[model samples]
Target chain A: MRSVFRVVENHRESDWTHTIFFDREIESTPGQFMMVWLPRLGEKPFTLSYLNAVTVKKAGAFTEKLAALEPGDEIGLRGPLGQGYPPLKRPALIGGGVGIAELRLLALASEEPSFVLGGRTADEILFYEEFRELGPVHVATEDGALGHKGLVTELLPVEADSYAVCGPERMMAACLPKLPAERTYFAVERYMKCAVGLCGQCTCSGWRVCTDGPIFPASTVAQMDDFGKRRRSKSGRWEAV
Target chain B: MIPLPRIDPPLINASGILSYPEVFTAFESAGACLGGYVTKSVGPREKPGNENPVVVYPPEGAVLNSLALPTQSAEDWERDLEEIKLKNAKLIVSVYGGDAGEFAGVTRRMSRFGDAIEVNLGCPNKEPGEQTIMESIGQNPALSAEVIERVRDETDKPVIAKLSPNSDYLAVAESCMNAGADALGCGNTLGPGLAVDIRSRAAILAGTTGGISGPALKPINLRMTYEAYARFRCPIVAYGGIETWEDAVEYILAGAGVLGIGTAFMRKSTHEAAALTRDIWEGIQEYLDGEPMSALIGAAHRAAEGGDSHA
Candidate 1:
């Protein structure tokens, strides 16, 4: 159920990212997401970055309103829903752009997981210091302003027994060739309405991302024909992503 | 007291929403207080529905969807139904087909899995040819009766005809009841409305036109229920844009024996549906304190006929 929560803390994480902590505690796993309701603006899903916090990147209309939220502002929150990535040994966590927010809780939960963080430029990189505290950190920026100067997938370690990746589908697809499909898990993003699985808006090749997974095994991802090919818009029309 | 296959609370999840088995179990566990759950429309074959954006929420409390009735085959749905564990909720499997034979075949196979079967004769997103099938079968009493009779021939399970509000639903309701349908799922989504994106200069939905639902659809569907109730004796399972306690009470007052909620659940979290259901029940209790449940059911019809002394 949705409960209105007052923002306890609103800290700017970076130039484009902000972290909002709720006064109420929420039980959530690393890869699970919560639907944030901004009264008149509409609802959008965001990955849980901390126990009671969601990190937002000012990317669109909903996120902009979320970013502008101040301490004491009220917003409705529903879930920590969906199947989260299972625990793994010898894990490697990779994230791209704001996708790093999705990996934050996972990294903290892992036993010394290797991290590969990527963004368009150095300014876009998020949670670098926090992630660095949890594991060995590798940074990649397309503009060559940070660690490896290409895609974050380029920096993913080749030897991790199990891997957790969350990012743009293209970025995850790029890493598929190098990783063992059985040992890798990827978190997918989709246009969703009822995060509990009613609205089939997030279905990818018959898989309802909201219920079947927002996080899926790489083997499952490999079988999804629409994985990186297309995504549905808010109006329910498919568009090449 | 809906006439066929008794269900308490008298509310069920509508078709096209909450198709997943886990979702059904979750809603029940979360205390949505539903009498039953209707699976998304299942057909003879696995249908990979229309291209995306399949759903849109207009500024009003309404939603437009062009999902094109995506469903796994009846065999697949039957198998999936086996895995679901509904605590106390009844299962009403909704089946759709391209033709009467297909509908009967699917209903025959799926009937064993649910307490009742809901025949979907009104999906607005069907292609022109398929639309003709739904329109012909739903609007033409003779054709609708034939289809219902064919389905009735397949199973002893209660058969509910889910009709289209876009046509003469009152006639369709009468035909369904006459043809052996035990009940009627009062309506499906209302329109093949277009939602255009001015910036893109294109229709927002992949199918171009989609079924209109949500709060905006309540009045249209309620009227359909009132009319159907006034003309027919079969139980009316009313659905369309019910989001509040008042909306639920309105449906009951309009002669609906059961309530079907879909878009309303979409507007809130699953757990919230339980709260809403409680509020609706409480509202009904408050109203019932003043009148009998029988008096509330078909009150509008009775008042219109100048037979309701309360009116």
Candidate 2:
């Protein structure tokens, strides 16, 4: 299922982040991800910002190369993989940093999506203008440089029909009590090797993130002891989150 | 021959492929279509295995992995197994070791959790010294038998020797049988094969090389299964590149009593994996017509000897 796609656009959002759109599109759902490959550099999982686009941040050597791609550069891609967000009505989307990439599609699909975007400063808040076009947008920055001075959790909307949260695990954990478990969904990440679910590399609490979910309801997240606390390293050893 | 644990469908998940005890619910979801569930290779000590890019798919309809057996300790697995629920399926625990002593220690600790114990004598990725463990023991008849004999001393449950495909497997198979192995897992993955991403000029797998599975290993491992079964006339669990029902039929014709499928599971969901077993079983029944299906074991070999084709 791996195919090469030409980079149609490499939109540099910041010094550390870039959004790359491809020449082709696939039927992908929100919360699902793609394993993006750059020759010799290796493959890594990235949440799709759109069916045809992935927003990446240069966090390591591999992603550093991903940041170097220009228009017409080819990258290997496999998926719209793993389970994605289930349909929701009047969903309130919560995102932190670049993790907002996972929530963009969900926001676009909803008729009246409410977004609470947060980061350390205004510069780190992603997709603010894009989401404002879709629905009401709330902003929070730890530095008090945006709409709200405190955490995004402080700006939670109580009237939404459902909540779709994707961000740091601890932030998602904090949102659990303010939102209903049955109506809240979290798009989590892990060190995934085989996105097809064979390698057991992305297992958390007994659930294969690549198969059972990358998106899980808050109730399911409650049962996972390892959530926000521990994750497996590349060698399969459990390490502190 | 002492009857082994009944694997109702004769199709089981191969060791190291979605076989972690912590996720035994995966096996439950795959359902009654599976005759058995094999655990990842447990060892005396917890192993972290190789680094990332552990698995890769080449365009050749195959998979290469150098996971190097990242296993939890035997103690952790015993604790994990107690919490799992596998309805109506047998459990075949796969265990590996650094040496014969380590193998015995792990088998003694984990054997009680399994209906049968599969000694993983052939893992090509865990290279601790001059040779990988598979090359050290799996390729040597005496070393393979010694490990099996020590494992035999540890448990009363059926012991299966999972040998390597990269060596004189039939000779190793014969030795394992004599060492009191109850059944033969008629070959592990073949060749520490290499796949390179031509543009980067770097190996695709982080380990640089890994065991070859999927379609490429089918013919080679099938021939090994056929020969090993013919020589020992014992139960054989065939592994390597079984994707469709026809492949299952070919292995059964080659004298496999049980089939261990890993690569095919890569392309299927848990729900789809369950359906695959039933599909293959239905295909076998249709191909067998009205004749008893068990009568077809080693039918190809019999045909070669100029005897009744269905004998």
Off by over 4 Å in 1: A1-197, A200-241, B1-3, B127-133, B290-292, B307-311
**Model 2 per-residue lDDT tens digits across residues B49-106:** 7655677887887789888888777776777787767777889999988788889999
Write down the worst ten-residue block by lDDT for model 1 chain A: A230-239
Candidate 2, residue A203: CA error in Å? 2.5
Best by lDDT: 2
Candidate 1 lDDT at B70 equals 70
Name the lDDT value of residue A227 in candidate 1: 86
Q: What are the per-model C-alpha RMSD values against the true structure?
A: 10.3, 3.3
lDDT of 1 by residue, B188-248 (tens): 8887788765433566566677888888889999988887777775588999987776888
**What is the Å distance of residue A103 in model 2 from its true position?**
1.9
lDDT comparing candidate 2 with the true structure: 0.82
- Model 2 complex DockQ against the native: 0.44
Q: Local error of candidate 2 at A210, Å?
A: 1.4
